[model samples]
Target: MPNTDREVHLRKAVLWLQKKDPTTKKIIQTIGPCTHKMIGNPYYVLIRSVISQQLSVQAARTMENRVKEYYGNGKQFPKPDVLVKLTKPQMRKAGLSFAKIEAVKLISKAYLDGSISDRKLSKLNDQEVLDLLCSIKGVGPWTAEMVLMFSLDRWDHFSYNDLILRKSIENNYGIPMNSKKEILEFTSGYSPYRTIFSWYLWRASVGIENL
Candidate 1:
């Protein structure tokens, strides 16, 4: 129940994962133990996902800082109600597209109104969480998958639609770009460790120091 205990428990999941897949074992031995912890609110994670859509990492962070500064007085991300109050034009001023502004509004309203509570969402499995989040306006499968892995700490998720993940697989495994079935089958061996594999693949895509 304590935060430290929870942190330990989550890291233990990574150890279990390392044992489950050899590729993961090799990756982690080089990268060191995965230290990712589930922190922050789900609503904020989803909002960031929406804002970062189709943008480079540098550009996305710039836009994200603008939104945070404008709504949160340069202190933190805006609270849900405050985020909802920011009108479309105001959001656009912060670099959000019209569609993304609407998405943020919908997600903020859901957060404010308790439709997307952390407690409720935390209880759902990855697939259920994916389905619920994807029901929102700007949340595609990739966005929902990101939320599941990074926000909720669901370790089994692998985004079939994530281009970076696909590229990583193709380059590392020599799987063809179009071979979705082969990719899925290969990754399935990772089982509960797929997200851990995904984290490594993401690292590999960016040129990990080891390889």
Candidate 2:
């Protein structure tokens, strides 16, 4: 959540979106209010997002838990040193694919070399953060965008290429097969709260809580 005045603006954002797009309005009505609790620690957020790629929610959580249990003493995720020390076979034993293991190792190497630090990363703007993180071999725009919203608590960033987000938009608004440029322009009015819009679309994607 934002500060008091920001909350006021967010409520107003809700109303403005309701008036601008019917699909958004219906979703706002049913979903009621944003309950997004920000996750912590940039490093952990990146690791978890990588682990979650192409997996169901439950399966992802299970794999994440396994990682935490083995390397993190069953309390929290391991630190960068622990991640760097774990061999590929050990990471695979934790249920990560070979590719994801490599990804995690690259991330750990970046951390150790001071290429990306929580302190340094926290100060960078969204675009800079995206570029720097994507410089790593395995990280990409989607993962960087997830870090922006989940870890850094940036409100405006959105992942245009996420399949589920695209599917949700199509299902709710009947706007599939549009180019990324058009989709982004269509969402421009959402502005700083695009992440909130994404949360609603994610809910809609599952068909369980959708209107």
Candidate 3:
């Protein structure tokens, strides 16, 4: 289970990051809100992560809509039982790649078999969650990191493997970042709120928007 006062931890993390490094201060200043819409449900989080993989926001949104339409009402996310029953052709018709369809099936199977559940996941640590998530086909470290940040609300995740983040870090630090390990090391100073730092990096990589 998460610490009782997760928000307190988040606030502490933000303060710690601001004090630890000047670059992080700039990042926080640039990206006004680190906390956005929370993905509280595991099923929705998994679905959104899958839909967004390797796709632009517009494309992902389109695909997500199509999937939701097929599932009906679009309010309730498709359950694992319903998703597992979807044939690859049907999923492909909904704009998902065959690989993604297969991956979704694997995840659904895991869920139905009691290997992955909401309560079970909440009991695991961050690393444990990552490990369990990666056991599913087509789910990688980056995807697992997304689940941790958006779904589980883990405050400290930094996806150094993200290209936009790498670019932002390089620009901020005035140093070329060619290795994920190096990026991880550089982000260590922003402990407990590395995800917030990462959100800032992503925003900075794009453009500043009105808060």
What TM-score goes with each of the models? 0.85, 0.90, 0.88
Estimate candidate 3's RMSD in Å: 2.8
| Residues 1-211 of candidate 2: C-alpha lDDT, one tens digit per residue | 4477667776776776678667788888988876654677889889988998888778988999999998898968899998999988889988999889999999999999999998888899999999999998778898888888888878786678678888777778777635677677766767877887887778766742421
Q: In candidate 1, residue 72 scores what lDDT?
A: 84
lDDT of each: 0.79, 0.82, 0.77
- Give residue 76's error in model 1 in angstroms: 2.2
Question: Which tens-of-lDDT digit does each residue in 1-211 have in candidate 1?
Answer: 5778867875886777678656667767776766655546687678888888888777988999998888887846788888888878888899888998988889988888788877888899877888888888888998887788878877787777877789888886788867899989988977776887787787766743221
Candidate 3: residue 62 Cα off by (Å): 1.5
The TM-score, computed over Cα atoms with residue i paired to residue i, of candidate 2 is: 0.90
Clashes of 1: 0
lDDT of 2 at 103: 91
Please identify which of the two predictions, 2 or 3, would achieve the higher TM-score against the true structure: 2
1-211: candidate 3 lDDT, tens digit per residue: 3554666666666777778778878777766545533555776788778777888667877888888888646855588899999888888898899888888889889999999997888779999999999988898888888888777777788886666678888989865768667777878867766787776777777542311
Best-performing candidate as measured by TM-score: 2
